[model samples]
Target chain A: MPKVTYRQHDGSEETLEVRAGTSLMLGALTGGVEGIEAECGGSCMCATCHVYVDEAWLDKLPKVQVLEDEMLDDTASERKPNSRLSCQIEMSDALDGIVVELPESQI
Target chain B: MATDEAAGLVVIGGSHAGHQVAIAARAAGFEGPVTVLSDERELPYQRPPLSKAYLMGKQPREALLFRPAAFYEEQGIDLRLGVSATAIDRAAHTVTCDNGTVLSYRKLVIATGTRVRPLTVPGSDLVGVHYIRTLADIDAMLAELDRVKSVVVIGGGFIGLEGAAALKTMGRDVAVVELADRLMTRGVGKTVSTFYADHHRSQGVDVRLSTGVERLEGENGQVTGVILSGGETLPADMVIVGIGVLPNQEIAEEAGVDCANGIIVDENTQTSDPDILAVGDCAQFEGRFYDGSLRLESVQNATDQARTAGATVSGEKKPYDSAPWFWSDQFDLKLQMTGITVGYDTEVIRGDVAAGEFSVFYFKGDTWLGTDTVNQPANHIASRRLLDAGYALSQAEAADEGLALKELVKAARKGG
Candidate 1:
């Protein structure tokens, strides 16, 4: 199992051991880590699962797709340079201990 | 309030809305025993993919679940799958289940959703005829797919077209029979409908419009072909019907809940009986976006309404005001719509429609109605935000493909 830390907008953090194959959005949802609404259920159709990856792990994460880049423009919160749709990020051993910060809102 | 201690929150239906109600209630700090009763044996799953990804075998059954099975236990939600609420006793604040179990609730949320309207034509009950409404329906259809060489899909709604597309992708001969003059007349505009019909035809699907299935021809109780109104017989190894759906509001209606086409709910999602609330496809809510009460059958409606109902149950009364949105994945095209496109007198097309990447911005005079975007996600999201903010783009601006919709949304927000 690989662990992922979810940092809330209020500066609180919660870490959970997510299954290797699950996406970060599902991991946060199953672990009850707040702030990831995942309205589209990992389809990348809704940008509600937007999260800012930790700067340290930004280079290691998978590159954003064109659709994701387009959807990032519509996030309810400001889209930082490291902003990515959590549903698009699949958890793996290489990406273990990755930290992602939640936005203020995901409407 | 004697029963309040033992009676927590009871939710009926395990679809999107019902599942969301439980999760949202817990998230809203409702510290009582939350129980969800679902007629389905499997955990609550996504219905949208049933005719697309799931039908194409791209997504497995596990992937269809809204949440992992263990998540319910962790949330203290007693998810009762394979059980259904047979009746609701409003006087006693109790629900009687088909399994002969009785459950009491402080607040009851009815998310019974809707069922497929059965095709009453002859041979409709043949073995090869199917309806795509549940996981079981898709699974059964999948089991027969290997043997099916040709399929005739009745109705031109989202389900029928998506199914036809999936079947065609699977190398099966598919024909879509629509009684209406255009495809998806109930949801999308004529332009969108025409585009889809043409697209399906280009993809080798026999798109039949203004054609009616007078009767089904069957061999040994299995559907073999469809007899058209003009006395033409189209051979089919299987038949899929997706005409429409009817809300499952029998229990609510029996309990004297105000009912029309669906269970009536206010902005707070509270039904006629204050103790009971209804959401999703089974709920007809007083319109905030359109005039008169409206019933929407989409994941967005279910999820948003459930959230509002959860808040109301937790004593946080937030009105249901989210703009309704829907999406469909057919072949390689992703169609996303925001707001209601009804009563639109004018439509603005952005991008290249010939290249299959464009959006139709519908407007009734100066009022913005909604937009239907194809292969354009940014426009879809921006349209939703614009509608939610009660802002409309000028006709000229919407027609200008050079202008990005996101920038316009930002400009609108800043202008306010």
Candidate 2:
């Protein structure tokens, strides 16, 4: 299991010990962590699950796909270099202790 | 009120809107008992993936669930699966289910989504013919996957095309037969329909436009081919039909709820009785986006209305006036659309369709109507925002590729 930390817009954090093979969006959603609307049900169709990954953990995650890259530009929060659609990121034991900050809104 | 028979909130249908009503009711601090009546045996799952990722094996069955099985119990929402509400007792405010369980509710949300409109042609009930609506439908279709070599899809709608793409992706021969001259005519614009038809053709899918199926040719109770209206027969081991869907508004209508094409609801999703509310495909709502009273059959519409209706049941009343947005995936092209493309005077193409990255902007005179984006997600998102804000972009300004739509919207907001 990997502990994924979801930081709210108000600087609060809720860490969940997520099982491997679950998506970051699903992990946050199933754990009842607020701020991830995931309107498309983790299908990568909607950008409602946008999250800013911690700068240090960027390379550890998989490379961003072109669709995700385009979706990142449409996030409610300003698109930083670390922005990624959390649905596109699969969680695993190898990527434990990953930290993601939720945007101000997922509209 | 009888506490045992009566509930605080009850949601009919178990798909997107029904599930959303339950979740939203709980989220809105509705402390009373919440129950969701789902006719399907399985828990609430995403229907969009059943045609694409699930069919292509990119994702498994468990991945289709909107939430884990335990989430409902944890949220204190009672999920009565494999049981359907047989009748609605408006006077008593109770719903009778198939299992002889009569549950009363303080507030009733009718999210009984549409069922598949069965093909009525001869031999339509053959074993090899299928309609894509539920998880069970996909599972039955999946059983014939290994032996199926050539598949004839009966409609060029989203489900039919997505099935064709998924079958093609899995190394099978596929063909689409659409009675209309173009693909997705009822849902999208003519240009988009043509683009998708060409896109499918380029992918080796035999896109047959203006073709109709007269009958299904079957052997030993199994479909083997399709007889066309043009007096030609196409050999196919499997057949999938996706013509369209009708609203499952019978339950509400029978209860004397005002119904035309569907159960009519006010902007608050309240029915004529006020105690009963309707949302999703079975709901007809008046709006400025479409030409007349609209009964949208998209997940986005269902979930949005469900949220509004759910919130209302929980003591918060918000008008459901959000712009409609929808998405579809087929053969590497992601199509995203916003607003309803009705009564548009001019359509502007923004990018190169040949290259597969383009957008079509629809406008009525100077009023921007909607946009259809293919493989351009940024445009899709921005289009939703612009449509939601009621900001209109002129055809000329939108046609110019140098202009950024988001920046234009921002400038307009600042000027205001």
Candidate 3:
């Protein structure tokens, strides 16, 4: 299992051991971490699961796909250089202890 | 009258809308007991992929779940799977389930959703005939996939086309029979429909428009062919019907809730009886974006309306006024649409349709109405934001491929 930490906008954090091969969105959803809507169910169709990854772990994550790059433009929150759709990130051994911050809202 | 302790929020149907109501109510600080009754034995799952990825065996069953079972238990939601609300006692504020359980509720939310409009033609009940509405339907169809070689899909709607594409990809000969003049006539405009029809044909799918399935031909109680209205019989080992859906509003209507096509709900998602509320495909309310009353059958509507109903249940009244959006994935084509394109007087095309990436911006005179984007996810999102902000792009600006929709949305927000 890979550990992931979800940091809220208010400086609150919750860490969970996500099973390998599970998406970050599903991990947060199953662990009851708030602010990640994932409304389209990990289909990269909705940008509700937008997250800002820690700069150190940014290179560890996979490159954003074309569709995801387009959808990131529609996030309710401001998209940063490290912004990514959590649904597109799958947990693995190489990406252990991933740290990501949740936006204030996911409308 | 039930005591306050015994009366809680009871939700029926247990699909996307029903599941959302329970979770949203909890999120809104509703401490009362929340019970969700679902006729399905499986946990709440996604229905959109059943015809696409699930049918193509690209997605597993576990991936279809909206939330894992533990999340519901952690939320303290009393999810009763394999149970259905048989009747509602409005005066008594109780719901009797098919499992013989009578539950009392302070507020009841009806999210019964919709069922596939069955094909009533002769031999419709034969084996190898399936409709894509429930997981069981897909499971049953999947069980027979190995034995099915040729499939005739009735209706060129989302389900039919997506299923046909999946079946074709799985090495099955597929033919789509649509009674309408074009594919997805009820949803998309003629250009999109024509494009899809051509795309499907290019992909080796026999797209039959203005063709009707008069009856089915079967042998040994199993469907073997589909007879067209023009006396042509197309050979088929399986038949998939996806004409449309009818709302499951009988329980609400039987309880004397105002019903016309679907259960009538106000802006707050309350039914005729204030204690009862309806959301999702089963609820019909006056459209904020379109004219007259309409019932939307999309995940956006279900989730948004459920959120509004949950707020009202928790004594926080918020009117439901979210713009409608939907997406369909078929054979590498991702079609995303925002707002209602009905009654559009003009349409503007952006990007190259021949390249299989473009968007059709719809407008009524000078006012922008909606947009249908094919293989253009950014435009879809930007179009939705523009619609939400009530910003109408000039036809010339919209048709200009040089102008980025994202920039337009950003400009609109900054100017507003």
- Top-DockQ structure, candidate number: 3
DockQ order of candidates, top first: 3, 2, 1
Q: C-alpha displacement of B416 in model 1, angstroms?
A: 4.2
TM-score of chain B of each: 0.97, 0.97, 0.97
Interface RMSD in angstroms for candidate 2: 2.3
Writing each residue's lDDT as its tens digit, candidate 1 over A1-107 gives: 89999999999999999888788988887676778888777777878999999999999988898689988987889999999999899999999899999999997
lDDT of each: 0.90, 0.88, 0.91
Docking class of 2: acceptable
Clashing pairs in 3: none
| DockQ (CA atoms), all models | 0.46, 0.49, 0.56
Candidate 2 clash figure, as a count: 0
TM-score of 3: 0.95
Candidate 2 vs candidate 3, lDDT winner: 3
Residue-level lDDT tens digits of model 2 in B98-169: 888888899999999897888999989888898899989999989888999999999999889999999988
Model 1 global lDDT (CA atoms, 0 to 1): 0.90
List fnat per candidate, in order.
0.38, 0.35, 0.44
Interface RMSD of each: 2.4, 2.3, 1.8
**B153-194, model 3: which lDDT tens digit per residue?**
999999899999999999999999999899998789888999
Poorest lDDT segment (10 consecutive residues) of candidate 3 chain B: B1-10
